[model samples]
Target: MSETTSFGDWLRPALPLLLLRLLIDEPGHGYGLVEKLRAAGISARGTTVYPHLSKLQDAGYITSHWQTPETGPA
Candidate 1:
């Protein structure tokens, strides 16, 4: 548990850099971003990841849009 806490402590300092890298290939939703972190060997859970997403959004390194379908019968 201590190791996990320590890693989380250390990793928060580099959040901006990692977030930049994650968005480099493509913009992603919050959950997709977490998977990208894992692919890079960073274990990012929702508690850790969402805050970083909030920070990155505040910093404007990326942007997000909700998907909409145009095939409605209306």
Candidate 2:
């Protein structure tokens, strides 16, 4: 495989570990987590991140709930 594909292969497995480390500090929403990962130099989109979130939830590594923002429509 090319270098880009090889890098992606490596990154895919690392995402879960990185996400768990982030969540250990505090809970966050999907978009927020994606941003945090991006800030940490991981290029992740919602499509990639959300499935891992769901897997973590399904495996009981994390939980989630909906909360309306103070200024947003509910």
Candidate 3:
């Protein structure tokens, strides 16, 4: 649909900002971040999010590491 496409376009520029906010949020990670954006109606994918993440990292706004999810919460 054009609306979804346009909305996605409109949202594309904001991915980095949103991603930063999500990182400040609890339990943030690769798939969870994507899912949250999708849930918020962004139609986010790696092509979009990964670049912004890389940019944010390059700018020293965030970092990444391997998170091993536990079977249960601590």
Candidate 4:
């Protein structure tokens, strides 16, 4: 594969791990995860991050909810 494609190949697998690691710091909503990914230098878009979040929720690695009064970023 070309260099760019190879990089993307690696990134695809790493995204879930990235999301999990971010949540390890605390819990986050969809948008929060997107920002954390960006801030972590992961260049993730919502399209990618949200679906992963859903999968993570289904897999029991993470959870979610509406922004509550005491909810904070992860």
Clash pairs of candidate 3? none
Cα lDDT tens digits, model 3, 29-62, are 6677899988987788977788888889899999
The stretch of ten residues in a row with the least summed lDDT in candidate 2 is 1-10
For 1-74, candidate 1 gives per-residue lDDT tens digits of: 35346777878888768878878887767778788888888887878778877777788866767676688642
lDDT of each: 0.77, 0.87, 0.80, 0.79
Q: Please estimate how well model 2 matches the true structure, expressed as its whole-model Cα lDDT.
A: 0.87
Clashes of 1: 0
Candidate 1 TM-score versus the reference? 0.68
Give the candidate number with the greatest TM-score. Answer: 2
Selected candidate, larger lDDT, 3 vs 4? 3
Q: What would you estimate as the lDDT of candidate 4?
A: 0.79
| Candidate 1 Cα errors over 4 Å, as ranges | 1-5, 69-74
User: Sorted by TM-score, highest first, which candidate order results?
Assistant: 2, 4, 3, 1
lDDT of prediction 1: 0.77
TM-score of each model, paired residue for residue: 0.68, 0.84, 0.71, 0.73
**Of 3 and 4, which scores higher on TM-score?**
4
